[model samples]
Target: MAVALLVALTAWAFIFYVNMIDEVHDSIDDGLDNSKLLIIHQANLDSTVLAKQSFDEGNYAIRKIEGHHALNHYDVYKDTLMYMENEDDLEPVRLLTTVFEASENEFYQLKVISSMVEEDDLIEDLFYSLLWLYLILIVTILAINTVVLRSMWKPFFKFLNHLSEFKLGKNEQVQLLKSNVAEFKLLNKVIADVLESNIRSFHNQKQLIENASHELQTPLAIALNKLQLLAENPELSEEVVNEVFQTIETLQRLTRLNKSLLLLSKIENKQFLNEETIDFNDLIKSLLLDFKELIEFKELEVIFKKEDDLKVKMNPELARILITNLIKNAIRHNFNKGKIELLITNSSFQISNSGSDKELDSTKVFQRFQKESTDQSSTGLGLAIAKSIVDISGYRIEYAYSNSMHQFTVKFD
Candidate 1:
């Protein structure tokens, strides 16, 4: 738009200058023609011959020309510079030359002149005035359009803010997007419908998981009790007792799996809303102590390195789960008699443990029931549960394998 305005201004100025100059030339030519007729009429009235002389006013000249040269009798006008006595300098002027027969066998050539200084001054003034007017008009229009556009897009920014703050399990109902613009209104409607459908589906899934996990707990306990009684019976055969023990172990695994699934569901559903300031170093130390027996059984070496006090805000249960899963995973997957390294900083916790030569599958590591090896002891939902907690807490977790060690890092922000 600015470029266009500049071009328009230049074109208009050029055209205006050309037209004004033409008008000034035309007026001068008309006066010259009239003066030639007047000079002839005056000569005829007094019956006197026209003489070659210049007027004292320095505006016109009469020159008696030879008849042979005057035969062509062509009239012409030109711009020229002439010296003026008062100014002591040559100034621009328009000169018109015309020849007429003043008497028999005689020709008179008349030259009429006019100063162009006044015309140039007038044109300069006119050009500046038009330029300013055009600039003012363009600037005013641009400013007004800027204000109008900002107001028009206000609703879109509002909708974006609301979407950023939206969360599952938020008690507030979805706010209907309202706007007068057709496109914006349509967008709002689509977003509202999609969110509503998703919320309903999430609630239904959460209810089903809660009901199934809760309902299975009672029967699982009774089965374990019955298996225990059968194992204590002295009359039972040795083979039968062994089979019952194996059955009991399978049921125990099922119970652990059930609990993990329920915990994962709860984390994903955002049920843990509690927040407390936790010293991550202390929590990690406490969790390591709880796993001291398992660590000893694995014959693994544990090292804790702290550079700063690692304090963070999150639900106490979730925080505990995140750290516990990380440390326990390290222990469960480590090489026999290998080493485990724990590092704590102001904003992060990292655990590196000796493991297999190959890296774990990062894509499937966070998925439920995904495991790196056939480790029957693990329900294979440990990392998945930890990831759910990290996600709901608005923290980040990363996994990597380097230096023959499996590394898991959690960033609290």
Candidate 2:
């Protein structure tokens, strides 16, 4: 609005200045023309009027010129500087030059001067005046804009504040104050509909996951228990016992996979909202204790280096899962007697393990079921779950392979 006003006022000022200059010149020229006619009339009535050669007391002068010189001559009005004895300085004045026929074959040239109007001074004064006017108009506009726009947009800003506080599937609801504005009222309605739709979808997804958890795990558990009992029976043949044990193992892996998939779904649905400041240094130490037996069985050389206490604020369960999965991955994929390096810093947690000689596909490492290892027991959801947790927590995780080691780094902001 301010920019538009400036452009409009500038154009108006230029046009007004031009028109005012034209009007001033027109008024002065009209007066000079009338004076010229009256002087010519007097000169015709009395010859003495034509005898004046210079402007001594009057504002006009007459001088005779040859007929050929006056032929086809047009009256001209122009600005010129003339000496004024009263001011004792050169003053700007308007002059009119015209040719008049005094008698047959006789022509007199007349020059008439107008009272001085210093156009430079006029332009300077007009510039200052217009400048002040533009300033006043802008200030007034800004004042009105502050008061009126603030009042007009109060409901919109308040609505946004409430909307920001609203979370899907949470106890809190977006509570907006009544507004007189039609657009704001419509906005409130649309937002309410969208939130209701999302809340419904969230509840449906949550219920489905819960149902799958109960319905699937119960049968898997019963089958595994019966298989283990069959393996315990002395009547069973060696081959049958081995087969039963294998079946139990497969069912166990399936159970783990189901749990992983359900967890991934929950993470994607933004179900975990609880958060706390988690110290990675302490978390990693605690998790490493749980993986000590496996690490030792692999005969891995573990190198733990801590430069600082790495800390981040996120859901405690998810944070534990993220670190645990990475640690398990590092130990599981590592070759027997290979090296594993764990580094902690103020803002990052990194773990690198010696695994395949060839690098894994970085693009597919974080994707579900994209396993890089030959281990059939691997469910391939460890890295995917870690990645999901990092995403929800607003952290970043990256994969890189260098010096025949697979490295996963989780960076916190």
Candidate 3:
């Protein structure tokens, strides 16, 4: 917009300058004609043939000739030499003339020529002055506009700073100070609404998890105790014992599934605040040890590799749960005598396991209730819990399958 205004102003200045030059030329022509008339009247050259010689030599033209007491044959001297010659677009030289009889058989011809070159020079100077004046004005206006725009956007920067400091689910409320601009006020209102809705949803989900966990705990405990007593009966037949063990396994799977679901819900709600510096290599080694029995039971070759002592600040319980689930899934989904490779680096950890070449949709792998294999004991909450933990920790989790290998990678800052 500023550039456009400047262009228009410049064009107007050019046109005005040209008109000024034309007016100056016309004034100069008129002044010259008046001076010629004054010289003829003062010197008394009326009715003299010598005046004709002087006029011809002066480059003035005779426009008309008039007789005494007659309107015709008026000998008029018109100065055409001083008219503008270089400008082709201007009209050709023109002057008005008339013969006046001073006495009987005596007459003086008067001519008027427009000559205003001095005025043209003044107009030229004015044009340059106005051009420079407008240039300075435009520069000043631009500088002022930049400063004003920066001041108007100050509230937006403040709002961004406040948002940057916000922590999801942890902050109970977001307050934005009022701004002078209506657009900024509207933006703040929208952000506040979204934050409020998210906080409400988080608290509601947390309450549901708490209630469900508490209500189911007593019944699950009683059932487990009754099953334990039944399995210990002395008179139980072999088939009855086998059947009881299967029922017990099914009950245990349900209990684990419930616990995993509750843990995932809590992680999503950001319920825990126990954050400490944890050694990543140590955490992986400990989790692998817990899964040693499962690895042996599946007849899988488990290899753990790492760089020593990669430390990060996170909740220890969440970290343990994440790694345990990942390793458990790897062991459960592997083929007999398959290899499970756990590799830990400074910024990331990878778990790759031997599996079938059948492709799994990696995009949906982290979604809850998504399972890659049909293991009866597998809860399908393992990867989902890992994903939630990674999100809360500001880490990245990805899955890839190639060369008959399923790989899970967790990247940390």
Candidate 4:
């Protein structure tokens, strides 16, 4: 914008300067013509006497004279032309003459000369003054614009700084101070609405999780205890005992799934206290060791690699729950002879499994209530739990599929 304004101003100044010069040129031409006519008239009255007197007074200097035609020089005085080659400090001027017969035996010769210094100086002064005035005007306009723009944008800058410092999950309410501008006031109102909606949604979801967990606890415990009594009965047949054991396994899966869901909700609510230094590498290795029996039972190959002691400050319980769900999910989804690999580094931890489940859409796998298969024992809450942990801990989780392998990577920075 500034550049465009300067270009426009420069173009306008150039056009005005040119027009001013043309006016001065025309005025000089008219003056010179008029002066020549007057001098010729005066000389016609008495050419010899006036010529000789002009020469003596150095007002007219004759270069050459013929009967009625002569070539002379004129020195331009205040508003009149005089013939002088070396008078005062003025420059010498030359003129052309032609004799014309006004009547029989009567003739007149005219000389014309013009000085352009005064006219040139007038045009130069006008252009320089205009140029300086234009510069001052542009500078004044720019200064006013800077102050106005900064004043108008002050509220926006304050709003942005306030928003940046807000912690979403931790802070239940956000307040914005009133602003002078109408636009800023409207913007603040919109932000307040959004923050309110988020808080309401979070509380509603948290209440649902807690309510569901509490309602399922009593029934699940009673069912497990009943199944245990049936399995321990001495008179029970082998087939019946086997059936009871199957029921207990299904019940156990439900209990574990419910617990995981509740934990995920808590994490989302920012209920987990993160106040301890934890070695993430050590946590992953320990989880793998604990799951050795299950890994062996499935006849799965386990590969573990550790690059560095990755340390982070977080809730130990939440961190353990996060890693446990990831490892369990990998083991459960693997093929009979498939391999489950865990790679740990300073910045990231990755779990890869050699299994193909085309029905699984890797992109939506982390969404709550999304199940990869119709296995009744699978709660479809593992990845959701992992995502909650990742979000609360300020980490990132991503899934990828390549060469018939499924990989889940968590990065911490």
Ranking by TM-score: 2, 1, 3, 4
TM-score of each: 0.71, 0.92, 0.69, 0.63
Higher-TM-score candidate of 1 and 2: 2
Model 1, range 1-413, lDDT digits (tens) per residue?
Answer: 55676677768767876787788789877877787777668766654435537745657777788998898778899989998878888988888888877778877787878787886687678778777876786778668766877788777777678777776666436565567888887887788788888888878887888798879988999999999998999999999999999999899999999999899888887777668999998898899999999999999999999999999989899899888998889998887799999999899999999977888889888988888877787999999999889888888999898888889999985
Q: Give the Cα error of residue 352 in candidate 2, in Å.
A: 1.0
Model 3 CA lDDT for position 291: 76
Ranking by lDDT: 2, 1, 3, 4
Clashes of each: 0, 0, 15, 3
Model 4: per-residue Cα lDDT over 1-413, one tens digit each:
77898789889988988988777766765665666565556556755533442344432332333544422433332334443455455553334444444335554444455655566577678978998989998898789878887788876787678777666456555557566878778888888899888778877877787788889988999999989987999999999999999989999998988887788768877767545998988788788889999998999998888887788787899889889989988988888889988888888888989776653676689998787666677788888998988888888999998667788999987
After the best TM-score superposition of candidate 4, give how far the Cα of residue 69 lies from its true spot, in angstroms.
Answer: 26
- List clashing residue pairs in candidate 1: none
- Candidate 4 segments whose C-alpha is farther than 4 A from its true place: 1-144, 151-155, 173-178, 226-248, 260-278, 296-302, 309-319, 335-339, 355-376, 387-406
Point out the higher-scoring one by TM-score: 2 or 4. 2
Tens digits of per-residue lDDT for model 3 on 24-90?
Answer: 6556656656666664564355445324532324433332234643466543434344434454344
* Best prediction by TM-score: 2
Candidate 2: regions farther than 4 A off: 65-71, 118-124
- List where candidate 1 sits over 4 angstroms from the true fold: 1-116, 174-184, 215-222, 265-278, 313-315, 357-368, 391-395
